[model samples]
Target: MSSSNEKRALSPDPAVAAPVGEVAVSVVEAPVAKKAKIEDDGKTGEEVQTETQEVKIDARDARDHGIARVKAEFRVPKSDYTVTDTVPSRDNDDESELNGREDTSRRQKRERGQNKNRKFGKAHDVIRLCEAIKDGGVCSHGDQCKYEHDLSKYIASKPEDLSGTCPVYEAIGYCPAGVKCRWMYSHWSKESNKSLVDEAKKAAAGREMNRIDRSEQLLLQRKKFPTPKSDLILPYLESVKEDNIARNGGNGGVPMTNEERADNAATYIEAPIKPGEKKRLNYSHAKILSPLTTVGNLPFRRLCREFGANVTYSEMALALPLLQGTKPEWALPRTHTDEIGGFGVQIAAPKPWQAIKATEALVEYCEVSAGGLSEINLNCGCPIDLVYRSGAGSALLDAQTKMLRMLKGMNAVSGEVPITVKLRMGTRDKTPIAKKLVQRLVREGDVAAITLHGRSRQQRYTRLADWQYISETAQIARDTFHEVEDKNKDGPERAPVWFIGNGDCYSWKDWWDAVDNYNVDSVMIARGALIKPWIFEEIDAKQYLDKTATERLEMIKRFAHLGLEHWGSDEYGINNCRRFLCEFLSFSCRYVPVGILETLPPRLQDRPEKWKGRNELETLLGSGDYRDWIKISEMVLGPCHENFEFQPKHKSNAYEQG
Candidate 1:
């Protein structure tokens, strides 16, 4: 029998064991929580079908308060419900359904976009008259071909190439789509009956494999993704499991005493790394970007990198999917060519088995030697309902022992790759447990870094982050790290765990203040980065930039160009680019220009009153309407496809679209 599955000789007395399932919190009946007051338009509210708010503000009072407070206000426009051309509206007959209703449905639902259900376009029955077909051979279909078989007929029907050079062909030397691609004429030479392919690029293509490189294709195809030490670690985990079963009288739900738990953990878990094996990460004062879902793709990370972000993380990949050899999950680890050393791949897993296996796969499939990643981050702070429901994201914060086991298992399997974690304050508002959690993380998790987002899971994005609590927790983390360091003096010299503060960091002032006053190793920006990707630039310069609308447009244009390059310049790619571009604009539009803002440091919670920009483009940039976002994307990506639809992730500011 395997060491892990072997029956223990001595079973512990059942009387001493409690339920091993996480310590269940008592469900006390509590009064219904009252809703917080609406501070901004981003709050939940319906379009006033029978009324519109009219405000009168004194210019002198506005200048004094830094915000225009309502001097006199009344509801107007009681006749018809206003609706945009792009947004669907209720018919006049159905207007009564909207009367006196809470209209919780007004918040826009999340969008998966064109890329989610993408399929390659239909392939021609007979191959086109390319050089390969011209070599006196039948088309790949051989017989029963529907397309024109004669080269002359095919050549005659082909359209002329008006769209300059094929950007993909020019860079890669070969067009994989060949004649089927819309831009075929750009690369094809009718006179020579050949492609004007670059020899150097052709040779380079043969050498590159993987998304980032072509040479690793063989390794990937063979499913050779395995960490060298995974075998050792897997058995150890099994032994731990066996011990737990033996000690708990075969019940996985039976909880052991602290001593019993420690004894089992010590038997299986080794130090995260050897004396010199840990990878050192310099996150101190780093301009770090959060791993924003959907919005944080490779092209966007490249854009952020160009704009001066020192560190960028991939969108969180689920562990089970990664272990199952899923392409989509694997793709999450693919980084930009430029993000060689500071790119981290974040993963979410509920159990040790998933965590360990996924970590092993990442270490094996994406080697740091191949510029695959810098670190593996455990995402424990995501408050999204879907993630939270999976007992992964913020749920890990509630299951402290489960979290510790998962982290230890991940570290053991990840080989040299340092492990980091992102955390929220706690699951509930009344209980802020991050400080206590930090002490536990220091003692058992063996993590290389910890990032604390200063909010409870319940708060999500409703209120401004409590930076004071973040500061307090950071101080606690620092103290705990010192204590752990002193205690582990005789052991391997692992790198000091870096502590980063994340939440509502929109400007250079916010970042610097957190690092300077809160004593955090660094600050991570999420919505702030999406709104103004160049916030890193501002941090580097240590000053707020009064970027003109034209300058901001240039940034958008750069994103469009980069998007086309990364996603490819084909129709499918163009549509995906436009979709993602719109997603970006949804956040980017929230930036109220620094020059026009009354306050020196703009509060993310404050909503601007109806105001025109210094320029038309600036006004367009700050528009809250989702259709305006599509309009801005059209400026660069060209008009979105007729079938295209965009839904902002933020429901609070979304227009009604069914």
Candidate 2:
């Protein structure tokens, strides 16, 4: 090699450094050939060349750079094409232009001529009538000379007036005498003849016959009880799952343990109270709560479901939480397959967009695989100061039109889910308008079911639930819908929606009493389940078992296990579980009484005398201290001892709302 050529080969190489999390760069090269001693292009298509191309570096810092796409030509065989797609033609101008023009023309014509057709037609009809009166004034109003000669001016003045005017007499063309003349033209207005006859003929048409459209109308409105529809998910007694349970992870919707299915004869469900007997009113769905984010308290929710409590609602999830992808809050409506038998997720939003977004979020997450959400409940029941002031929750009753809009928004995105609603009676005047509010929801909102708490915002939970008024309201609701079917017979379709009663319900007797005496469809159980997780079992058992202290301890243990398995043993979750478990104990402890109240005041939740003493509560917990409640909570919830401590949820009202 020449000295000058050798000098060029010894220069240092320049290569970019590797990225933080990237593949190493490769120094690939082509074979080097001896120098070509030749012309630039006699043989253009074929050339012997060895080119040194720079490597394609994958430097992570390039992420901050802007991209500019440059076109490059390529000619490859058809087989080399990875994908082939047919392209649509871009030359359909006339079709698109004609469509746009037609739309614009239609709109302009509607604005300029369509709405004015009535006025224009009326003018033309009068002109024709005037001509008729001029040639032959057939008058039924041959009058007593005041404006006796002129009925035409009166007819023109009152367009729909049919009885007293001549169509031709502009002011009065004489003939002042009183008589029925063919020329005075008076008995009826000409415009009525022009349109009324046509309208009258249309009304004369009718259905060949009318029969009681049972499918079209629910019998509860005005007839007898409705026969149940087939194919509905059967409500099995809350059977135990000991045999079906696996030591393996994931429930897989298989909760029936082998022992449970086999022991079906072993009193799996307590017997139900017969209708018409004296019963507790505290077993109905009441104390409507917001489906607050993060699921309020899972340990409490599980306890309610495990005992076969009637109604369970999820925390009220915000519309924005789902739409904007906020963490955790977006997952508030999450539920399980076993829960769908009696589950409702109440969603809240101040706008139509939120309702749409929230309903979509529910559909995506609340599937059978994730959590089978049974009902999509709109949260129009919250009475909190902040929520009420925001024009959501109970405040929605004031704007029926807006309420309809939100319901429609939810329905649009709900897919196959039934849209249920939870609402307060009203902001005020609970009784009189109860019927009206229900009618509006039924007619305009198209709700599957409605759960009305018996108090208004003014009353809060301070006053007693006016049961008779709620009963009357529900009766009125039934009657009003009965009249609607009779009116809009051929307009559309309808469905039989269940009217669930809600309020202070805490015992088995309250449920049976509400159903038989007052005639309600179903009852919701809330604080009743909270105070006594096993209240459902006791209800099913016919007579109160008073649950031996040992049984109570067993439940506390199971609840703790479910809580830990769900919340995990992380620091945050352990503390959260502890706080909620304590809150639950504060409630459950209220159920274990030293003696039975031959006549307990309706709901046990209403009166905690059942388990009220510091010592009595301890005895109930199988111990004489509150700390035992935490220890029981811990045993089931896994080792949450060193990591977290339990906290109380209710105010120090001492004996107030548990």
Candidate 3:
């Protein structure tokens, strides 16, 4: 078994024994509970025993109490359940339903982890309004349209308006959902049967960029979208591959002579574009939010931006889906107005052709004139099993020659949009290959930047990021750059490739340490940003801010409001917002309040034991239970639908009952 799995298999301390099959072993030693002492009553002269209540201790306090390790817990028990009752029993109906397993027997036998087949059903209105009626535009179908034409009937049948004003209308001066909006009463007139619009606000509202036009999408779907640049670059890449094969004795198993090799080199075609010609990128000391999958949606990016994230990347979109003109894939590149100057579109491809074409499409559609794309990032570090098995993501690390070709082709057709690559240490744990890759990246690949996530594909988040290895690699990249520059003194001036280190950077100290000590240009934050959206602010202040529970809730409210504006103010939108909110909370709840922390900088892996917050609201915000996350969502997005369900992507998020 792998070290990570072995770590999980180890049992907790027997002395502090929890219920069978419920205890999760912590790497950190458990803090010994203080013993209660007997006290004498002054008036009665009778001895009285003092009751022992739960005591809260911070990192410092835990250490002061002779504890050698931080008392951390990945899975937390609900408020009603004692620490011993952390994980719920299979017999619990509520737990089973929330876990998406209705049968108790199935729940008992099944191992806890990702809910791969979880279903999300959209909420639909009983009487759907016609697009013509909603937008005041003519419908081509006219009377043939199945949608309701009578605004009165549609409004009457619509569910009662949600409380409070419409966030979308409040922000942009008009609700796109119109009368069908959940909060329509805030912007609708009963007598006039018309939706109100703030003409001035609507006109002044900043439009989101990179929305794929219907015509462009249609062209892509028909495989007619012009990829003139890719057409040229792909043939050149293939010719180079053929030449390499010939030189390596592929010509009837006979190796080419020196004369033949020279001839082959002379016949090699020059690339359409050079590294120096690409747009310059300066990410020095920048705080970047990593391209998270489902949790890193636009609303969350917007929140991080408000909190001072220097750069944000879109979720990794698959090249196949993007080329096929799938709406979901197309949506990955969509950026909010605030993200225009700092946004990057990350794509994953298994082949050179796919990478080249995908880059061309992104550059063509998401042009600078249309919002803009800072860079095209090739994702080579995703550790998901499905992506890895498909010969993409981290699998690229194993296929370096193919990977280098993909990068080269991407650079050729990317125009001014610089192509960057995100990578891992290697495919397997303890086998670091990035140091060697860095030399090749500088000498051959014309990438704008290189981001090395300090973990191997096999390590995942099971171990701490290897910043020492990342530092060594960064140094190698610098030395390689100098060597290459000296070798090509007469060549065009190229920008120095920025090196970014990612993984386990949870605090300002972590960020600064990577920059100051590790020789990295920047640190890409993933889980850290999810847990504390205001982490950038902390970096700026160079100190931890003890955010009140109210302040945190307000942030949650802002995210929900932004989600509504981006997704829509309709039932489906609300459901999406609620579900994503829960997803965010799943990570956010892992944050141990700085105010309660006895230590200055908290490590990402140091999971705190069950501890109360300064207040009830703070405790709720720090809850590990998915149900509490829903309660927090209800406070903002309103109650979820009866069929609404959420299962955390990590198995450790749920606990078993005692």
Instruction: Identify the candidate with maximal TM-score.
Output: 3
lDDT assessment of candidate 1 = 0.68
| RMSD of every prediction | 15.9, 36.6, 10.6
**lDDT (Cα) of model 2:** 0.47
lDDT of 2 by residue, 1-658 (tens): 1111111111011243333332222222222323333445532232343334432322321211321111112112333322101111114434533543233323221111121121100111222222223323454545432232344553454323213332212112222211222222342235433211123433442111112233322432333322221101011211222222333334655555567556663542322211112111222333223243332455556566667655566778666655555555544655543354456678777765566556755665455233366567887777777778887787777766567666755554555566777777778864435568788777653577777777787676655576786787777666766777678788655555567777776666666567666646776655566666665654554334344455566777666545544553323344555656665676665563322222222344243221222233334363222345566665554443342433233212234211
> Total backbone clashes of model 3?
8
Best of the two (1, 2) by lDDT:
1
Against the true structure, what is each candidate's TM-score? Answer: 0.73, 0.51, 0.84
Instruction: Give the per-residue lDDT digits (tens) of candidate 3, residues 283-388.
Output: 9988899999999999999999999998999999999889999999999898988887789999998888998999999988985655469999999999999999
Ranking by TM-score: 3, 1, 2
- Give the Å error, residue 521, model 1: 0.7
Q: For model 1, what is the error of residue 469's alpha carbon versus the real structure, in angstroms, after optimal superposition?
A: 1.5
* Cα lDDT tens digits for candidate 1, 552-646: 88889888766766766655566778888888888888776654544345655555554556657776887766667777987876655544666
The lDDT per prediction is 0.68, 0.47, 0.78
Off by over 4 Å in 2: 1-299, 368-371, 429-432, 488-493, 570-572, 592-598, 601-645, 654-658
Q: Model 3: what TM-score?
A: 0.84
